[model samples]
Target: MNETIRALLSKLGGLPMPVADLADDADLYAAGLSSFASVQLMLGIEEAFDIEFPDNLLNRKSFASVAAIEKTVAIIVDGRKVA
Candidate 1:
């Protein structure tokens, strides 16, 4: 599975979702995503990727799109961060 799908699944928490059903350009928030779950999703992503989410990226806009999260993760992966 791609990082974006993985992140989305992790973000889903216990929502019983199907990652493959989501399109790359899918609207995560509108796709049954909740504010509380978003935070958990971020945490799940951080743990899965072993990268901390930057303060500047801690916003609804960042989590609004899977592509955006993938982009942010790419940036995080490109950068050298502490484990």
Candidate 2:
């Protein structure tokens, strides 16, 4: 899941530095993630994970870093199984 998130970030993050070169906790916004790009990234995540991000998880903090995104996706995916 982390690897897939990183791949999606690399393709969609729009950061000045490569996503692979970034640490898991690196601030994606500081690395050049624009608001528009974040939306695109979210869309890509939804497609890749096949899970819709609940409205509650759509926020700056949820997409703040690779770890955050990974955690958020895991929560959503896990919730889907119990539904």
Candidate 3:
């Protein structure tokens, strides 16, 4: 999942540096993630993981970093399993 998120970010993040160069907790926004790119990254994540991000999770913090995205995606995917 981390690899997938990093791959998606590499393709959609529009960051000045390579996704591989970033730490899991690195600040993506500070690395140059634009608003539009973040939206693109979110859509890419949904498509890749086959999970929909609930409205409550549709905020900056959810996509703040690689770890944040992993946690958010895990929450939605795991919740669907119990449902």
**Candidate 1 local lDDT, 1-83, one digit each (tens):** 26654555654643456656777677777777788888888887887778887888898887776776788777777774443
Candidate 1 Cα deviation (angstroms), residue 60? 1.2
lDDT of 3 by residue, 1-83 (tens): 99999999999999989999999999999999988999999999999999988999999999999999999999999999999
- Candidate 3: C-alpha RMSD after superposition: 0.5
TM-score of model number 2: 0.96
Q: Which residue pairs of candidate 1 clash?
A: none
TM-score versus the correct structure, for each prediction: 0.75, 0.96, 0.98
Better of 2 and 3 by lDDT: 3
Candidate 2 local lDDT, 5-63, one digit each (tens): 99988898888888888999999999999999999999999999899988999999999
Order the candidates by TM-score, highest first — what do you get?
A: 3, 2, 1
For model 1, the superposed segments whose C-alpha errors exceed 4 Å read: 1-4, 7-17, 81-83
Candidate number that wins on TM-score, 1 or 2: 2
Q: Which stretches of candidate 2 lie over 4 Å from their true place?
A: none
What shift in Å separates residue 34 of candidate 2 from its native position after superposition?
0.6
- For model 3, which pairs clash? none
Give the winner by TM-score. 3
Q: Runs in model 3 with CA error above 4 Å? A: none
